[model samples]
Target: MKSTVEHLSPTRVRINVEVPFDELKPDFDRAYKKIAQQVRIPGFRPGKAPARILEARIGRGPVLDEVVNNAIPAKYQEAVVSSEDVKPISQPDIEVTEIADGERLAFTAEVDVRPEIELPELEGLAVEVDETEVTEEQVTEQLDQLRARFGTLSGVERAAQTGDFVQIDLSAAVDGKEIEEATTTGFSYEVGQGGLIDGIDEALEGMSADEEKTFTSKLVAGEYAERDAEITVKVTAVKERHLPDADDEFAQLASEFDTLEELQENLRERLGQSKRMEQATQARDRLLDKLVEGAEVPLPESVVQGEVDNRLHDAVHAFDHDEERFAEFLAAQDKTREQFDTESREEAEKAVRYRLVLDALADREEISVNDQELTERILYQAQQYGMAPEQFVQQIQQAGQIPAIYQDVRRSKALINAVRSVSVTLPGGEAVDLSDLLGPEDDAEADEAPDTVEGEVTGESAESTESAESGADTADSTEGTAADAKA
Candidate 1:
């Protein structure tokens, strides 16, 4: 067997392979055995017929076809493995070029390959992050949050207000016909949370206990979705949260701290830590933007198209593949199919570019994910999806997505390395020290460090409170590639 590679482009290649007949004996044997089991012979038991007898019955063409089909994939894999520099990122388009009776077989495969990238100096990269500042008001807000957590609800003899919680009965009717799914009694809701049907807050405000008010709002879900319905809400009880006084007794009750001043100081310290984490997050994102801007990456068209197809398929799947309903959804968003396609293409291209850049960086830096790091990421993702780790692992394995997870973890480590190397400064030109927040770069500690999604450092202790909300912009701005790719 022999193989040769032709460079089709910076990000693609064509491999031509030739396998002599002697090398395909095993493949031929397997093909014959497989076909024998499918075809019946007059004198031989099932799967026990001689190859020549089967060939005589079914013809040599069918046998050769089966052999070629079975041989191509394994040969292609061998050719790929033999070529040290050919890193295919997409499935190959294969064509059998020639077959000479039993002498030799030849084929060619064209595929998207990982491109060669010229990496910028990691240490030379510079970025600016927001300076960490914990104001007195921020500390007070944190303290107030703690106080509210221990607060008791007191029944108020007045109208419902923004901070008040109310017990109410809600019933909705569309065209004077009641919708059972939309009707509930004794529902407890905060006055201004706005999650319960739209315009509920307006109807609840200024309504005293035992007061009933009817208002019309659009039902966003259930059978009455997008239809205007008359909702009648009867407030049975109105209660305001009464926070304990901020003194020694309150401090002792709320925390391990025995004095109010100590509690306030602790709150301030926590707030400061949060701000610092925010600063680190901002730095990480800015550093990534800088790195991507500095590097010139060639995106593989096939990979980008594959990603776009996956996204488009997922979108249409939500409407059960009904194009008309999808079009309606687009129209509701004030967008056309053309516009959506255009945006999806752009996003796909950007995502591919981002992945290619970080992948090349990982290769150049020799960044690798070990078993423990991979397992930790898998565990974290399982928790995110509310699945048991074993179940999640089984599902991922069945889907052949273990490699994708490994790639995500590798890319995350690469990006973290990049972040650590970059020069991060504050707006006032002061060099910010993130050593305390990011921790040391020892392998044992890095393996234990919380994994980042995409290119952002996330789930650090300081950022835990705001992790769900704060990283959203970074994730969205990057088009979810950071998290998806473990960037």
Candidate 2:
């Protein structure tokens, strides 16, 4: 067998492979064996039929066809490997130019390759991170929220008021035609929560028990629906929130604290932790922006195409396999598949570029993940799926997602380390501790970020965070790419 490769782009290649008849003999033999067991000859049993007899009975064409089918994929892959390029991001477009049952077989595969990157300056990048400090007002606000969580609902004899809970069976109609039906015999709502229709709270504002009234409101526009429908709703019940007595008993019942003051302090600590996390996230993003801005690597087109395919696949799945629905979806987005691909092409390229940067940084730093960290990540993931830890690990391994998960963990650590290596300045010109900016310590104990949605960016700094949120705007921004969902 002989092979040759031609560069089509910085990230694409075309490979031509030629195989002589001698090399095709193994596949030919296997195909003949498979065919001999499936057919019978007049003088011989099915499994006992000779290749020559079978050839005369069924023609050599079918056998040759089978041989080509079984042989091409393996040989093509071997040729590709021999070229020493990274694995193809997608299946290659293959074409056979010559094929003979006992003669030569020739084919060509066109595919994308991982791009070689030249990473930009990674150290001493300029960035600013927000400093997180717990305040008395923040503490008090959190305590109030905790109290609200413990508040009880009680039926009200008088007209309902704001901050009250209401339970009602709601129905709607339009132009004398019943348009919507939503019945919850015990449906509860906080008057100003806007959990229901926009005018619902106003409609219930002055209503007493057993008092019924119908009101009209506009339906909120969505991705597909037009915005002209008016809805009618009838109220059935209203109730007020009754605050629990903020005493020692309440504190003990609500938490592990023995007194109200202790619970308030604990609440303050928790809120501080949350605020710290938000601040950390903002700083991390800012640092990433600086890193990406400084990066000088050329993105691999294969990786970018892979990303585009992923985005496209997600778009396709959202339509639920209904062609009309898919078309309507694209229409609503003002995009055709080709157009969307064209638009996301740059984003896809950036995504792949950032990923390559992160991977390379991980390798350069010799960053390693511990078993405990892996176990923790896996366990947290299991909890999200509501499965046992061991069970989730087994399922992940069985599903072949373990390597992906490991890579995710490694990349996360690498990004953190990358950020850690940088020094950040505050708006007031004070140097911020990179450790404080990376994350809070309790992140290990708290629930991990939801595996489904990407980790949301929280908090904002006076500078850099804005651009970071906009995505990597600078050469130094090294924000990792968002993960792809399972296929």
lDDT of each: 0.76, 0.62
lDDT of 2 by residue, 373-427 (tens): 6576677667656888889878766654554455456656666656556666777
Least lDDT summed over 10 consecutive residues: which range in candidate 2? 459-468
For residues 121-159, write the lDDT of model 1, one tens digit per residue: 887778898867888998899889999899899898999
Best by TM-score: 1
Name the Cα RMSD for model 1: 5.7
Q: Candidate 2: where is the Cα deviation over 4 Å?
A: 100-103, 173-181, 213-230, 245-249, 296-353, 356-382, 387-407, 434-482, 485-487
Quick one: best lDDT, which candidate? 1
Clash totals in order: 3, 19
- The whole-model C-alpha lDDT of candidate 2 against the native structure comes to 0.62
